[model samples]
Target: MESLLELKDVSIDFQSKRKSFNIIKNINLKIDRKMKYGIVGESGSGKSLTSLAVMNLLSDNLSIGQGEIILRTDEEKVLNHLSKKEMRNVRGEDIAMIFQEPMTALDPLYTIEYQIIEVLRYHRKMSKKEMREKAIAMLTSVGISRPEKIMNDYPHQLSGGMRQRVMIAMALVTEPKLLIADEPTTALDVTIQAQILDLMNDLTDEHGTSILMITHDLGVILETCDRVAVMYAGQVVEESTVKNVFDNPQHPYTQGLLKSIKTLGDRSEKLYSIPGNVPTPDEYQELGCRFATRCPFAFEKCFNEEPPAFQVGSDQTSKCWLHDEEANPNE
Candidate 1:
């Protein structure tokens, strides 16, 4: 498959008067055309930050320290190199993002029609009639029964699910090549979550848009993504197909996460959880594997050296010394 977006050795730096350091380092990911790629991890992992970097929407305190976020559509575009104005043009027309909370992302003062029309007004050259028609059609495509009525409603007037559908409609109205869905279903109920996920899959398929799905929910990744990247302590610990991740997890963190998922009809009152919180960016060591502090498989080498990504399978890569035969040779 042709590549859509590529993050090559991407590192994000957090700067302050007191200190400057990297929160996420040396991340490499290749998202293929029309491929649904997922980045899954707990809070403090660089899942959302990575997506933000791709969108050039990182805050004032943070900046891309190294590497490239290249978008390949009509031509090769180094997203980081583009100016603010250039990026504004690229955002809705080429790459759009569905944020975590539509409640917060959407403007409460503006009507749904006005907000949706604004995207088309800025990124597209359409008259009032065309914009209104397109916006309504988009809402309808996202499974809104009365898009015309919904269009006039305020974000607060609609339910969470409806607002999210509006967000999806706004995101897809321009027919962007890539959609960055940063935990889009987090704020909704279970039934609504499923509906939103299904709606996104169907709409993106119809529009031929690839998705970079960032979420802590492993089930969401399984449901929507073909490829998955397991992030821990601001780094990609494992990158593989969803099948390989479920069947044969390589990284210790990935293994631990899979074990953490609960199944139905459990007798024990106790729930499984990964021991220790993800180390804060300040606590991140200058040397050694970041997962070494919590990993059960950590050896002398894990604390003394940083492990490079080792090719564990034809399509899988793992960042752990245990996968390196030379690092811990068997007797």
Candidate 2:
């Protein structure tokens, strides 16, 4: 697959009192054309931050302190240095985003028709009738039964599933090369979630759009992704094919997470959960593994020295001492 978007050594930081503190450190990921790539981690683990940085949507108080977000179109376009006007042109045209919440993402003040057409308005020059017809066609394609009637309705007038479908319609209307879906199904019920996931997968193949699926639910990742990166405390601990990461997770964090997933056979038993919580900014330790404090496999090396990404397979790496050759060969 061709490289679509690449986040090289990307780091995001928070600025306060004329000083900057690292919030996301050394995060590297490559999303390929037509690939459904997932980033899975607990809330506040910086998964969302990394995706936001890719869209150049980071806030004033936050900045990319290092690395580049490159969009490999006909040639490499570094998104970090693009003017707001330039970035505006890129968004919805080259890369579109669907937020977790459809309610907030769709303005209450605007009708669904106004919003979907607005995307085309921003990216392309079209006659009023042309844009409206395209908007209706896109909505119908996303499975809205009454696309014409629903177009006149406000976001609040629709069901959650309908609103989300509208969001997808808006995102996919441009047939963007990349789609960044930040837990787009989180707010919906199980059936709706499955439908949305299926719709996205179908449309992605139809449009040949690569997707970035960000969610805390491992099940969601396993169900919808081809490749995945497991993140912990703002850093990717392991990255590989979804099958490899699911069946042969290398990082201690990744292992613990997979073990925590509830299975049908173990349904009657108490559900497993990783103990402790993701550390807050001030609580983050300066040395050693940031996850050491909560890690069940932590030892002196784990608490005293940071572990770098160790090559574990042809396409897999884990940031854990357990993968090191000398990490106690006896064990």
lDDT of each: 0.93, 0.90
Cα misplacement distance, residue 94 of candidate 1 (Å): 0.5
**Candidate 1: tens digits of C-alpha lDDT, residues 134-253:** 999899899999889998999999999998999999999999999999999998999999999999899888889999999999999999999999999999999999999999999989
Those runs of model 1 whose alpha carbons end farther than 4 Å from true positions after fitting are 329-331
lDDT score at residue 203, model 2, on the 0-100 scale: 96
- Reference-based lDDT, residue 31, model 1: 92
TM-score per model over all chains: 0.98, 0.97
lDDT at residue 188 of model 2 (Cα atoms)? 97
Clashing pairs in 2: none
Report the lDDT tens digits of candidate 2 across residue range 1-331: 5589998898888898866678898888999999999999999899988889989999999999999999998778999989999899889989999998999889999999999888888888998999999999999899999899999999999999999999999999999999999999999999999999999999999999999999999998988899999998889999999999998988888988888877876756676778899987656677889999888778788878888988899999899887775873437
Model 2, position 30: C-alpha lDDT score: 92
